[model samples]
Target: MFAFIISRLLQALPVMLTVALLSFAMFAYVGDPVAIMLGQDYTIAQRDQLVADLGLDQPFFVQFMKFVVNAAQGEFGLSYRLSRPVAQLIVERAPATLELALCAAILALAVGVPMGVYTGLYRNSWLSRFFLTFSLIGVSLPTFLIGILLILTFSVWLGWLPSFGRGDTVNIGGWSTGLLTWSGLKALILPSITLGLFQLTLIMRLVRAEMMEVLRTDYIKFARARGLTNRAVHFGHALKNTLVPVITITGLQLGAIIAFAIVTETVFQWPGMGLLFIQSVAVADIPVMSAYLLLIALMFVTINLIVDLLYYAVDPRLRIGRGKGAH
Candidate 1:
C-alpha cells in the first residue's frame, strides 16, 4: 500500500511539471504580464524598471526555473493586483471552495445512489422510467442555467433561501466556515443543489445500470434462492457490488465539482476559488491565475490518486493482482 501510494505520487510529479510549464508558457507567450502590471501611462524607463523588478526582463527558461523552484517551496510570489502573497489568498479562499465541493459531493451521493439502486431494481416500473427521463434532462441542461433556475425558484420567487455569499461564518483556527451556521447552511443549499443535480442524475443512471447488471448475476439469484430478504439481497449484495464504479465516478465528479465550480460560483456569487479566479483574470493577475491553475491540477491529481487507492480497498482482486505484479 505504501509502495503504491509512493508510485502514484511519483507519477504525479511530471504531470504537475508539464501543467506548470504549459501554464507559464501560455502566460508568457499570450500576454505581456509586465505591460498588464504597468498601465499605458508608464514611461519606457519606468516600464524597464518594473520589468527588471519583476524579473520579466530575464530569459524565459531562467524565469521558469526560478518560478518552479519558488513554487516547489510553496512560494507562488505576490498577486500583481492585490499585492498579497498568492498562497495566502488561496488559503483564505480555498476553504469555501472545499466546503462547497464537499457539500455538493455528499448531496449527489446521498440522493443519487439510492435513487439509482431503486430505479435499477425496478427498471420497468413507472417511477423508474419517470426518474430516468428527468435524469436525461439533468444531464442535458447547462450548469449555469441550473444555478440560475434554482436561484429564481428558491431564492427569488419562493424566498426560502439567500441568493448569494457564504453567509454567517464562524472562525475556527484562522479558518472561516459557513457549514456550522444556520445562515451558512441555508446559503449553501441552492448552490449545492445546482452543482449536484447533474452529478446526481449521472450517479443515478450509472448505479441503475450497474444494479441491473449485477441483479442478473448468479450470486444474486443464489442469494434470492437462499431466501434472503429482498432488501438484503438487493441492497446488501447487489448495491455493495455496484459501489466500486459508483465511487470511481463520484470521485471523478467531485474533482469536476471543484474545477467547474467557476460557473456555479459566478452565478451564485459564492466566494470560492472560482470567483477569486474570475476576479483575478479580469485584471490580468497572472500570479493568481497561474497559482489557481497549478493548484487545481494538483487537486485533480490528488483526487485521482485517492480514487486509485479506494479501488484497492473495495476490490480484493486489485490488491492481489497488484501484489503479484509487484513480485
Candidate 2:
C-alpha cells in the first residue's frame, strides 16, 4: 500500500508540473499586471521599477522556474487586483468552497444512492418512475439555470432560504465555517442542492445501472439458489458490488463539484473560490487564476489517487489479485 501510494504520488508529480506550466504560461501573457497595479498615474520609471521588482524583465524560463519554486512553497506572489498574497486569499476563501462542496457531496450521496437502489430494485414502481423523471430533469438543466430556479423558488417566492452569501460563520483556528449557525445552514440549502443536483442524478443513474447489472450476474443467481432472503441477496451481494463503481464516480464527482462550482457560485453569489476566480478573470488576475487551476488539478489528481486506493477496499478481488501476483 505504501509503494502504491508512492507510485501514485510519482505519477501525480508530472501532472502537477504540466498543469503548473500551462497555468503559468497561459496567465503570464494575459494582461499587464504593472498597469493594473500601478494605475494610470504611474511614471515610466515607476513602471520599470515595478516590472523589475516583479521579475517581469527576467527571461521567460527564469520567471517560470521562479513561479514553480514559489508555488511549491505555497506562494503565488501578490494578487494584482486585491493587492494581497494569492495564497492568503485562497486560504480565506477555501473554507467556504470546501464547505459548500462537502455539503453538496453528502447531499448527492445521501439522496442518490437510495433512490438508485429503490429504482433498481423496483424498476416499474411509480416512485421509481418519478425518481427517473426527476433525474432526467436534474441531468437536463444547466447548473446556473438550476441555481437561479432554486433561488427563485426557495429564496424569492418561498422566502424560506437566503439567496446569496455564506451567511454567519464561526472561525475555528482561522477556518471559517457556516455549519454551526442556523442562518448558515439555511443559506447552504439552495446552493448546495443546485450544485449537487446534476451529480445526484448522475450518481443515481450510475448506481441504478450498476445495481441492475450486478443483480443479473451468475453469482447473484447462485446466492438466490442457496435460498438466501431477497434482502440478503440484493443488499448484501448486489449493492456491495454496485458500490465499487459508484465509489469511483463519487470520488471523481467530488472533485468536479469543487472545480465546476463556478456557475452555481456565480448564480447564487456564493463567496467561495469559484466566485473569486470569476472576479479575478474580469481583471486578468494571473496569480489567482493560475493558483486556482493548479489547485484544481492537484485536487483531481488527489481524488483519482484516492479512488484507486478505494478499489482495494471495496473490491476484495483487487486485493486477492495483488496477493496472488505477490506470491
Q: Which candidate is the best by TM-score?
A: 2
TM-score of 1: 0.93
lDDT of 1 by residue, 1-327 (tens): 888899899999999999899878766776677776676788989988988988888999999988889888878878888999999999999989989999999999999999999898887899999999999989999999998888899889999999999889998997889989999999999999889999999999999999999999999999999999998999899998998998889989999999989989999999999999999999878888888999989999999998998888888888887788755
lDDT per residue, candidate 2, 124-207, as tens digits?
A: 999999999999999999998898888888889989999999889999999999999999999899999999999999999998
lDDT of each: 0.90, 0.92
lDDT for position 64 in model 1: 92
Badly placed stretches (over 4 Å) of model 2 are 41-48, 324-327
The C-alpha local distance difference test score for the whole of candidate 1 amounts to: 0.90
Clashing pairs in 1: none
